[model samples]
Target: MTMTDNPPAVADGFVVRRSIDIAAGIDRVWAAVTQPDLIAQWFGDRCRLDSLEVGAGGAFGWDDAGDFPFRIEEFDPPRAIAYRWSNAVAGALDPLQVVDAHSTLFRFTLEERPGGTRLTVVETGFESHERPDAVVEDHRQGWTSELDELVALVEGAA
Candidate 1:
């Protein structure tokens, strides 16, 4: 797996964008991202989703990190999934009570390549947080490591 930081010129400085090519088809990669079971294998230790449709809500957490509430903003099967969540107050408050000021938007896009899938993840809105630089840097590292894990899981299965 190869990850690159490609923040769009139009985006605010707080954005963290990464793209990687995985040795798997779009369907397999999409399932790994949207399904609770497969998402847990790479994203978090566990995940719970109310629904997979746009406007649906859910929670995802790890043993070390408490759950965070998330609302789906966009859902396009095998292609894209966008959600809003409060990572600014991650383990400090009840995620269910998160407001727009405390949340960031995360988007995942998948494009079918000749031999595999190109997966891109972009997280924005860190400027709303108290510590934008820290938050953005933290997520940049987090995404890099997490995406590497995702690549390993999907490619290993292939």
Candidate 2:
């Protein structure tokens, strides 16, 4: 339940991270994240996940921003899931198009907290991005608003 407090040095390391406590159980939070239908309610307008299998492919789309392709890098049921996605490009991205070091990886880590669940989304690998500032700013602000919506959706359902 204890994560490192230090943010990685900014020289070459870039990260946009956010953690929020939701007044819901882990299962509820997990469903909101992993299930495509529920993901659409919070994260993106369209969630196209092939499946929940670890290596499955997926895409999150916004009418204005375009589709971003991603592959499941890690899947651990209701506990965690990590997605490696192509952040720089939009629309019609192939799952295999993401180069390991070039693309960004965002992980959702869930921990049971008293009377609720603590969900943390940490996105790294921004240093490889052509416009790291734009990427960070986009996600930094996105996560803030997205997480607020997540809390509203999940807690409201409870």
Candidate 3:
């Protein structure tokens, strides 16, 4: 995976934004972002999408990071998907619980370019969490690596 020069930026205080261009169509990119099997290949060790609808919820588990509860807030196929997820904590939580101030919003947007797709990811609401700086920094590194992996997977397939 070739990492792009696009650096993560702090937006609206604690929000982090990262973007990359992938050599694939919007449908392919969307699947890589929304499908659990495809997401696990890059985003985490394992992922289980309980639901893919706008009001659905899911869980992602990592060997080292434990589990994260996520709820889908928006689902626009081949374009955008927005969800709120809990920060990495020690214990497991209820995926159906309401998103509190501590949770963060992750939004993935795809735009069709001339030859491929431009993917942008924005994660916000870190200021409401404890150790906002550390969380932002951790996710900054994580998104960079994960997005690079996504690019590698999708582009390789192309």
Candidate 4:
């Protein structure tokens, strides 16, 4: 596994940001992230989406943690993508006062480096969570483990 100079940290109160450099090209990294088959290898146990375009609906399922539904907020090829999901009800989008209040948006940004690619995940909107501190900490640690798996898979393929 490669090393990350900067580990994930919560910033600006509501955002948790993390970045890792993978020993692979942008295309490979993009495929691993954007493709359902490849994402299952790292991000979740199973992934389902209506389509690849923005505003698509999907769910990431894990036997232990259950499935969480999400909406595609952005879809830019080989560069960036983002999803908004709400965990208030677990496995579904909660009917909160404001949709944005209880929903979290996670963005993936990929940049081509000379030897590989740098992938960053920034998840925000935790301030409105029932337990903001706990939720932030959970996801902050979650990203480390999830991306560790992603780096292993992508780098091993490279």
Candidate 5:
């Protein structure tokens, strides 16, 4: 199939998106998110969630960086959590810094399917006039690795 024939319309650089049906209930998945220790184990290298309240905020980052610059844009408990994130490395090929707005959206949605929970992650709005392709691919690779890490941690393999 030609590029046009593909229905999903993959973006130019990298349309990096993936979802997995985790063999755990929504509650388990929710626990993995709201709990700071569990989140650090699964998703973040290190994380701090302020309040679980809908309007409350949180911060997270990899090992070296203490916390990523972000606030909870939306919080719906076990259903969904949408937050803003930024890497802030100007002119260094860092994808997360593409947006001049100082933040990009990272949304996680959980659905209860027949066997387990369907987890969906979306990190978008990385189109910058400076470095579009590099930014897109960087986040794509990062998210891919992140999802893999999440699966491993949830399945007790990591």
Candidate 6:
């Protein structure tokens, strides 16, 4: 995975292109990504997953925030998982007004590299956001920290 010294470029109100290398096997990385319990340790404050099967749906959010509804639009075990992220109502929270106009896609690609696994996350379809730059930066930091946590968790460094 290429570690960019700069954040990815924001194109059409959407930022794309960032990858991370984890010192773990694809299976380990896949588990950390697809499993609800482990995902929260790395990605979110809390994760509520119904299934990892293709076209399945789930909700994941910070413990302090409401659950964000999501649907598994595409899934390929141990290789890729693409999902639709929404700020819609999950538990008493109204639909996210800021995210209502934009439909974002999160794609996770995993590959077995020579030393470990290379994980790439690409999010697109953000040209509709009023503040796309801010959103991009938010995700940039979020993914970076999450990937770091994932590496630590899978490598027993945490």
**How high is the CA lDDT of each candidate model?**
0.82, 0.80, 0.81, 0.81, 0.63, 0.71
lDDT tens readout by residue for model 5, 65-100: 445655677778789987766655533334322233
Model 3 lDDT vs. the true structure? 0.81
Number of residue pairs clashing in candidate 3, backbone atoms closer than 3 angstroms, sequence gap of 3 or more or interchain: 0
> Residue 101 deviation, candidate 1, in Å?
1.2
Q: What is the Cα root-mean-square deviation between model 3 and the actual structure?
A: 2.2
lDDT for each residue of candidate 1 in 1-158, tens digit (9 for 90 to 100): 44333332223488888888888899999988898898889987888888899888888787887888788999999899998887755567676755678889989999999888998899988988888888888788888788888888888887
Output the better candidate (2/5) by lDDT: 2
Rank list by TM-score:
3, 1, 4, 2, 6, 5
lDDT tens digits by residue: candidate 2, 1-158 = 33223222122247877778888899999999999999999887988988898889878888788877788999998899999888676653554465666588999999999988988888888887778888788788788778877888888888
Superior candidate under lDDT, 4 versus 6: 4
- lDDT of the structure predicted as candidate 1: 0.82
Q: Worst ten-residue run, lDDT, model 2?
A: 3-12
Instruction: Report the alpha-carbon TM-score of model 6 versus the true structure.
Output: 0.80
Those runs of model 4 whose alpha carbons end farther than 4 Å from true positions after fitting are 1-12, 89-100
The C-alpha stretches of model 6 lying farther than 4 A from their native spots are 1-13, 88-100
Clashing pairs in 6: none
State which candidate, 3 or 5, has the greater TM-score: 3
* Residue-by-residue lDDT tens digits, candidate 3, 22-43: 8788999999989999999988
Candidate 5 off by > 4 Å: 1-16, 64-66, 90-100
Positional deviation of 1 in candidate 1, in angstroms? 12
In terms of lDDT, the poorest run of 10 residues in model 4 is: 89-98
